[model samples]
Target: MPHKRRVYFISDRTGLTVEALGSSLITQFDIVEFQRITLPFIDTVDKAREALAEVNQAHIDTGQRPLVFSSIVDDAVRAEINKANGLVLDVFERFIVPLESELGQKSLHLLGKSHSAGNVKDYNHRIEAINYTLSHDDGVTHRALDEADIILVGVSRSGKTPTCLYMAMQFGIKAANYPLIPEDLEANRIPPSLLPHKAKVWGLSITPDRLHQIRKERRPDSTYAALDNCRYEVAAAEKLMRQTGIPFLDSTTKSIEEIATHMLHEAHLVRRVY
Candidate 1:
């Protein structure tokens, strides 16, 4: 049996960065199991000491040193956390020094810099894009298709809605998604509402088996969720996309992030947010 090590991600704000970095590093050591804990908003000395106590307790319980990944910017708080009976890896301590040296300047050591709302314009854009995506989901309305940066078209449950929302939230892209219904599939053509913005359209395809499984979870034993219906829908949708020369991608094996990123690259759309 593999020994499970305790892992902590402590941050001055939301511990997203530390968690992302820690998870990435931990995955490289496949032989070891990890029990993850996140301690966010540890900006004060008292909070830091509390976090240290938790880390020490984990170490005592496990009879092994826990791994601590900290992103605290305050020197005093960071020092307090370093006193824990575990291995402390501070992200800012490791990289900020090199960045300061390279830039020949001191770092601001600011908190909440990673996901700050300091850029009002960018923040507003992201909010607007998210609202737009929500309103336009599943071909609910084609009223504002002209304002969309990208339009995703695919058969039902082909991973379109999530991909659209991800692009909107992560990249500040105005994304709209439309489902290709059986009527449009039978006609072997694109939707009339999307025809005006055909250049902004991208298609997503998934294997019929995968689609069948997904639909079955929503409506088991129904004709809509039947394997044969999934096969026909996918085949017709793919054929229509091919006949129209629309660029498409398979969503079966790709994550929503990968799909949105590839769509951005293929469409040559610039991301408004990082």
Candidate 2:
């Protein structure tokens, strides 16, 4: 087996951009293992220096030259990073330099400017969608019943949380999820809270053996994570979804991006890319 090089993704703004670009970058190097460390909104020069020192320490400790993939927007901030010991790859510097040359104009760096803000209606729609998502997030399991644009129900570790978060983040969709508890299974009825929202309910199903393997890692030796239990919950939950006329997706072999995209397409929801 070939050894995987450790690559660190650093950002002094929202780490979302760094993560998104890094995922694309890693696809080009299929054999390399990636270790991600996100440093978001370290905007000041002092903070930038501290961040660079830390990166150098990590490179020395690991005895490996770490690849720094960054999107530090401020020129002074980026300058501090370039002084570090390891190899640094700056996305803005790489792209902007060539664009400046081609356009035959000096490129001015403006760090905090946003070009587009949608109309009032679109702005209100996003605000409402975000409010719904936050109010129905993972902690308040029951609120998912009332406010979701779509409710995804499944057995534990069937990828409920990640799918819901992705829908909210990628699209401006307010997504909620519920785990099919043992009591709900025994009753053989979809929870009453979800009945009124039947039209918007969605389901996710996973193979029992695969779910069992996933759960085992979390709470090993418990019957809750057993193969038999997973099979029963999955079968019952899926049946409930279908019987209630809820449309669903099998999340067994799909990546998080693929699953979110499929659901968005099926639901006719538009992705509000930032």
Model 2: per-residue Cα lDDT over 92-207, one tens digit each:
88898899999999777766443125366656766777677666754365754565678777777888788887777667788877676777777877667777887777778899
TM-score against native, each model? 0.95, 0.65
Q: What local lDDT does model 2 show for residue 188?
A: 72
Model 1, span 21-106: residue lDDT tens: 99999999998889999999999999998899999999888888999999989999999999989899999899989999999999
Cα lDDT listed for each candidate? 0.93, 0.77
> Which 10-residue span in candidate 1 carries the lowest summed lDDT?
109-118
Q: Whole-model lDDT for model 2 versus the true structure?
A: 0.77
